[model samples]
Target chain A: MTNTEFIKSLSEKTGMTAEQLEPMVAQFIGAFARELASGRVVSVQGFGNFESREKAERKMYNPTTKSYKIIPKKVTLNFKMSATLKDKINS
Target chain B: MSDKVTLQSVAESFSRACGVPKKVAEQLARAFFDTVVDGLSNDESVKIDGLGTFRVVEVASRESINVTNGERIVIAGYKKVNFIPEDGLLVSNLVSDMPDVREDVVADDEETDVSNDTDETDIEETSEVDDETEDVSEDITTSEDEEPIDAVEAEVNMVEVPEKVEVQEDEFSGIDMLICTPESVEEIRLELEQARADAERKLIAAKEAHREVLRLEALLDKMEKSMVPECAEEEQTPETEAEPVPAMVAESVAKENLTIYEDIPSVAKEESAVETADEGQKAEEVAQTPVEPVEESLETVETPSVVETAEDENVTVNLEATTEEPSSEQEESTDVAPAEEDTKSAAEEAVQSTDAEVKQEDVTAEGAEENKDAQAEALNRLLSDKSAATPEPVRKKKDDGHYWIWILTPILVILIFGVSVVMYKAHSDKEKTELKQLPVEPKNHATPVKKQAPVVKPKVETDSIQSNTNVPAETTATEPAKSKAADNKSTAKPKTYILQRDETLTKVSRKFYGTKDSVRAIIRANKFKDPDNVPYGTEVILP
Candidate 1:
């Protein structure tokens, strides 16, 4: 769904305007990103969990070029769906 | 953040960030998630900027086995929510925070950077300090140069300071290069020289051992040949006497000496002859009836001893008498000779004694026959004992041969193994020296022409040492000396290295040139098919 439609739906549910909810949503996302970046698991009770996982550096071979390149280490954000959310989506 | 951050913490943080009431912030956070879930459920996907895309992917129905039972089952298709973070938002934040989370990994990168920075700073600081010292010295000189006489000394002092600094810089660069390459090369060369010396020593010891074994074998062969003739001489008398006695005795003794004489005719010949003569005289006195039998026995025994003695004395005369016996026996009768003469005489005496005692005692004749039979049995027993004694020497000779064979086999095997070990060591040493020389050759070539003269001297010295240690490796040694002379005029030659455990082509190249840029050159020079997975201890040539 588009960000506006989602924000519009969130504002309606919270009895707040989209303009007010937009800043609140931004703050919420920033906090979530900050929590995940800090290597903590962020759990939204009925929704899902967000976590950061470390990816180690690895060598990659390009067969066409006949060359090897080392891919740098990185950290990636991962999401795991809560059982309740999974059931809700399936149902 | 806590180990687990719940929606309440997010709301609290959001409230702290936006100056909203806690309850309002909590409501907004709850509403935000609720809307995202609603969007996901309706549209099957949701894209949140600065967050991520939440896509509901349809998983296909597939066959599976029940874990608890041996039964096939199918899993019904369902949607799985997959989250993909927005480009650079989460990653950038996580990466920025990564140093705090994982310090060890970051420390490595930092250490390398710190080392390089420290090196540059150290050089700059030294130069700055030198400059400061120069300035201080110049000021002191200027202060001292109030006298015209001291002014010339100040100029000399001024000239000396910059020269010292320049010389120190040159020393630093030279020390750095020595630390990087030349010292390791020298250490490897020393190791190679030590190994070559050890291998040459082993080769010398092995060659000495081989020569010793050869000398021992030659001595053994000479001893064996010398012994063979003596053995043959000792065995000859018994063999010849045994051969004719059996033939003569078998015909005349009526099988009386058949078993005994056949086994040991040579041993009993003389003894049997004397016993038969005495018995013949007894038969002559008893009745003269058994005289013929006694005489026949006498002649049979006497012929072998006489023939053996004659053959021992003169082989040609024995052979002539043997051929003359059948023809001349009747002309010279009653006297026992060595062949048919003895038989004919015995027959004539039997005729004469039978005519003389034809009517004398019959009982005495029977008794003499019984006595002859008994004596023959005793001679057979004695002959059996002699036959048993004869082969013991032969068996001993055979056992000696076997013993020698057993002794020599292990020595030969040990010689083979030792020689092989020495050869293998020499081969390995040659390769090691060659590999070691490759690096030195390149260094020599890389050096300026003026330094080449000194480098050539060491090469010649090593070659002379090789020649002194191993004559066979002299050719190989001289080739390198010649090549080193040629290398003085050429570009740097490729050096060879055996990759150590956990070492790679890049590591070798880095070791040679202080940079990994020459890895491609090394691989090309060596024609490495698999540059990434080269086995350890593989010889690589560094260009």
Candidate 2:
């Protein structure tokens, strides 16, 4: 979602005024998400983890068209479920 | 599919999609989060069945290990907890089934789609149940060709109904074989409808409850962040604005539903998504409710029953705030409206009026000072004149010159003409005697003058009253005090006197000083001896 869209959605979900919500969201995201963007792992006891990893840039050949192209290196957020969560889900 | 949703992005998107301002959306998201925290804090299972559950886990206190060094550390025993999303079920459900749902449902749906590829296919079968009644019959006919439920149960410990299948005829008549009956179909349909209705109601209640929790959480957060620590209050307090929003919305929706039930169409998945977003907003307001203690101190001066003093104070504060704000605003507007001459004229006029009131105050101060100086000079002249003229019988002296001009001159001219010397001396002597006698009759003449003074005072007072009508009553109070003091002094003079006979000391003293006790004072002043015997003919001076 775009920043504005996300803000609107959050307001709808939370019923908070946009004036009050903006700084809070900014602060929360600024604190925890940056580390993840830099390929750091965030692990909580029960909740999932947000981690970032660097994928090696590689060239791949298309099977049908016989075309070769390079895939750019990108960072991705990977989530891992806690054991408690896994148990709850299985149950 | 479920792409990475940063909290920031979600806050922003939620704001945009819900038509709420960005800041409010973020706070709402936080509030919802804090509500989950509170739920976990209290050890309540915050369950969003499809999404995730948040609960407090009683982690036994144990020694910790430093991951890098592999060193164990002492840990304390306490219950710790965390928030876990049931994948996307809770979050998506919060959005789903609610009108005005956020578009974030798409993210949730994509993830769940990948994880359970069969779920969507199952939904298709379930959704087709209403249309597949006859098809179910046909399947029953086909399944008759196969082994019955007992045979199936023998192979499996428990029969798990795949999404669409239902065991309609489970009751056995006499034989071990389970038989299908029309009554079973009717029961199944009834059961299905009842379950769907129950789910819808539960969803509604859950949405409302969640909204309330969220609103309270938001309020708590606000209070925690507020400058005044006292503003924070215990959660779940009613009588707050946050508490009522969801209730009001619920009431309004309930009322609307009652009237327009037929106008509404069948619920769709997309519609449910929108409803979830709407419900989230209500939840946020609920979370925000607990912080409303601050409102009581807002001192809404508009209350009709409010005392006049409070109203006046509030008005004064408002007036000051208004003045402060407008002056800066005025300056800005004036700068911008440089080309608008009329606007500039009006602005200047307002400024001029304010300055004029200040100038008026200065003028009033100067006027009062000048009046005091004029009154002081008049009083000094009156006092000095009285002191200077006391020794001389000044009234008679001033009249003597006037007599010569009128009477003596006329007589002298007659005498020079040698017309009647005797008559002229007699008339002239008579006039002289009359002039001498005039100063002695002070009381007889002063009565008319005293009476006239009272008359003149009333006229002066009336004139002042007419001229200074616009002046405040407080300003005119001093005028009456001055007039009354003058009248009081005039009426306070000693009125009785006595004459002495045969040079008696007491009689003589009483005649001079208007009091008999002055006789001894006179003896002391004159150093008289034998006061009763020698003083009889000695012409003793009266005190």
Candidate 3:
């Protein structure tokens, strides 16, 4: 669903207006990114976790070039869905 | 701690997590499970957004064997609920920090976020101490709001009930750390202490192993150093005395080594061996012979050696000749068998008495070197006794000749035992000095030229004995009359001697003169009274 449509549906279901949910959703997304960038794992209950993890630098072989190249290390963001969330979607 | 997670427990946990009464949560949980079952039964897929998906897929009709009954059955087609987790949710729930596909996806998401907008970044690190402590006491199977710690925003979403513990029927992961109980804190402290102690013990063991290795290396080095010196000594021997040794010289060296190693008093053992051999020979030689003839033969054996010894005028040679003659007589007697053993016994007694005399002389020779004068005197007295007897001392000389042969073995044993090497060494040195006097072509040998010095003595003695044997053989070559005449001629001059107990006139005659004819003469004088029997202690006058 589009953001607006989902907001209206959630407002109807919980007896809350789109205005309240809109800010809450914004805050949720913003806080998740902030926590993740800060290296804190943002574990959304029954949904998924957002986190940044270290990716170690290593040598990668290129078959076409017939040589090795260093793949630079980096901090990457991760999203892991909670088991409850996964089970709910399939059910 | 409970083995399984059930729906009721999850519902209770959910109820507590959401601040709802447990009955409402239980009813809701039942309805949710009922709806999922119904959807799967209708061949539809059900999705619970925050949880997971459950889909029913067709089960094809097939034959299967029943294990219980060994029967095959074709069951009708059916649908099975196939749940495929979305976004790898199942991977996130396992207990340890086992980075599954969930972590990989999270890492990807992290990268994507940073790439999109990198401003809201942090460098926060989780405390390893908290990680270690929480790892213990995690098996209680309770669900608290684990999302509250890391993300402040996530905590607002979880409505938690205080003073209520929901022992949930679901697995959770590292994100959860309970509000620390005093008991759990104590357990954590103990576990940390144990881990630290283990690390320290391992460090000590490693250090000890290193020290032991070093000690072993030092011991190996010392052994190698010690072995090197032995090799050097072996190497030095070739450089110092590089010459081939003669067999005789080698034998001499071995004898020296034997003397050093055995350290037994070899002379006594040698003497006993020689005496036993001589006794065996004499027992037969004097067989059926009266005592007088034996004394005659024994004297003859001693006479030649005494003359040879006196002619040399050497005390040492006198001793050796005296020692040698008894063995020669023993050797001669070894040839005769005791046809009449009574005379043989009497002969043995005479031989033993002579042996005692020889042994006394040997003892004198063995006395101190300063007592050589006494030894020479004793030997001279023995010599005088042989010459003074009017008749030939052929029998005594025979005994002495027997002794010479017997004495050789013990001499060789002692020479090869000790003195042989010393004599051989001296001979070798003399040969080296008189190289021109030596035969030049014997260079392959290490023997000395003057090796002939001691070697000639045996040949000389053997020649004398051979000539002596030749004289007897020549005399016996004639008819029996000439041999008897020769015997009479040899026994013509004799001295008077007393007869002992068991002395027949024949025995007395042989003891005094080495003849049996005197028995006839003595009986004629006694007028044939007890003709065969002559009583003991008779002073028989020699005819």
Candidate 4:
């Protein structure tokens, strides 16, 4: 779903209006990204837990140059749908 | 805990919160992407209490990591986990309400749980005490929940039960009972103390019981050892100490024992073997003949000696007894047979000797049958005496003789036979060698040489005639020619010599009408040119 559609669904499920859920949904996404950037785990009750683990910076060879270079560690964000929320969407 | 991430962004927030790189965040996110993987890896269940839940599924291996590199790696392969949401979570204003969905679906299956999860904190503290107590009562078969505290509870129950009348089946009946008053608690405490003392006493008693069993077993083994030798001593004592009684009994039984003297050869061989064995020796040539006659006499002489020797003859009986390690009953029977045989031989020997004496007296007219009996008695007596003597000095003498006989006889026989064989072989060998060297081929060769001589004889005759004429001296023409013709005739004829009469050299020339000097001429004519060394008493060819 698009971000706006997801927010609208969340507003409908919690019986809150779209206007009220827009900021909450944005804050949730922002908070998730910031936590992911710092490499910490997030646990949600009635859903699942998320944890980050170290991945060593590797020497990845540049194919064209035929020489190796360090691939610096970078952060990536992720999303997981809860079983309760998935059931809600399916129903 | 305060601001936990929502389900949608939990994986994203974990990586951001931990400040790991995007690749690592993606990996962490992927795990949350699979909710089953996340719960299982963390060893936690995502239990939405009112909803159907996600659980940390147990598998053979939960996760794997590269130990060297410290990288979190998925344990490649499959594991079992799933999610089930409750009806409440699935429906609200945004979703349809399905009536078939359960109101509560979050209940865990404790019925299947094998044990309460023993948190790490409790294990180290209690395990030592439990293990020590458990080892001693290994047969009690208590499970995890029924651990060592049961013993303490058992002690507590002992106190509240009525004294002396409390039966063993009711041993743990009063456990967890309450006391109503201070006075009652005091009484129960006193009882508990007494119960503790009684338990100590019973433990001591059980130990004593085990020790007693051990002592009784040792005593039984000692008694068996002591009794065995005593029984053997009892069996042996009567045989030796009261021999006369058995002997008298043997005499009464003599009529029943007649077979012993019948087998003398076997008995003699046995005696011979025994003697040889004692000396560890061979057959002495002198002893061989004597051994037979002595064995024969053994039957006719002392009764006991015959009996003893006969006993030796049936060596198989005793040897079989030893080898089979016969049962007591079988051994008893085997021994009985030998004893009976010995008695009979002794009696027979005695009878033979006495019978001989009676015969010499010519008692044939009176009771001649009684004579035989009397001789048997005498022979028996003699046999007994000989047997007694033979075992000692006679055995030594016989043994010595036996050694030399057995050792030397075959060797001497071999030596004599060998010498004869060698002489025969040498004679044959010599005959063969002589035959090989004899003049077998020369006989055929010598005839050929003799035959060749005839071919050369005519040439020899012409040459001899010419030599005589050239050698002639003071001969008239006719005389010389006549002499030449005579020499030719003599050479043509086979050369033979003839003895002349007593004319000697002087007379021969005169008588023949030639001078003594002509004797030389005659000798030349006859080819007796060496006239001074001519063979004596022979003259030839006056010409």
Return the top candidate by lDDT: 1
Superposed model 4: Cα runs more than 4 Å off = A1-91, B1-298, B301-397, B405-410, B416-420, B426-429, B441-530, B533-543
Q: Report the number of the highest-DockQ candidate.
A: 1
lDDT of 2 by residue, B1-543 (tens): 224455555556445534556776556555555554444445565653222345566656788898999998877655544445333222112212122222223343343334233323332343353144321122222222122222323222221221112223111110111112243244345545644554444344334334433443443344224312211221121111111222222233532321221122122223433433443354345423321221111111012112233233333443343344533323322232222222222322323324533343233233223323333332222211211111011111112222234445655786777667777888999999999998658635653333343457775444433323322222222334334423442232122222223446664443334456766876786676666654333444332
Residue-wise C-alpha lDDT for candidate 1, range B1-543, written one tens digit per residue? 348889899778767766788999888888788877887787467877667788888889999999999699999998878998887555434536434424532443344334334433533443343354321122222222223223323433443344356445434422322221243246345434544554454344334334433443443344335434543453354322333333234223422432333234356556466655554564456434544463434334334333444333333333334345422322221111222222222322323334323222122233333433333333222222122122222122112222345556667999999999999999999999999988777766542432343557865544433332342222232334334433331222235566777777876665444457778988888898888999987888756
Q: Write down the C-alpha DockQ for each prediction.
A: 0.26, 0.02, 0.02, 0.04
Top TM-score prediction, candidate number: 1
What TM-score, over all chains together, does every model reach?
Answer: 0.31, 0.18, 0.20, 0.17
- Which docking category, incorrect, acceptable, medium or high, applies to candidate 3? incorrect
- For model 2, the superposed segments whose C-alpha errors exceed 4 Å read A1-91, B1-5, B64-72, B87-543
lDDT of 2 at B539: 41
Residue-level lDDT of model 4, residues B112-153, one tens digit each, is: 111112212223333443354322111111222133233323
Q: Pairs clashing in candidate 1?
A: none
- lDDT of each model, Cα atoms only? 0.52, 0.37, 0.38, 0.38
How does model 4 score on DockQ?
0.04
Give candidate 3 misplaced runs (Cα > 4 Å): A1-91, B66-71, B98-543
How displaced is residue B141 in candidate 3, in Å?
63
TM-score of chain B of 3: 0.20
Of 1 and 3, the candidate ranking higher by DockQ: 1
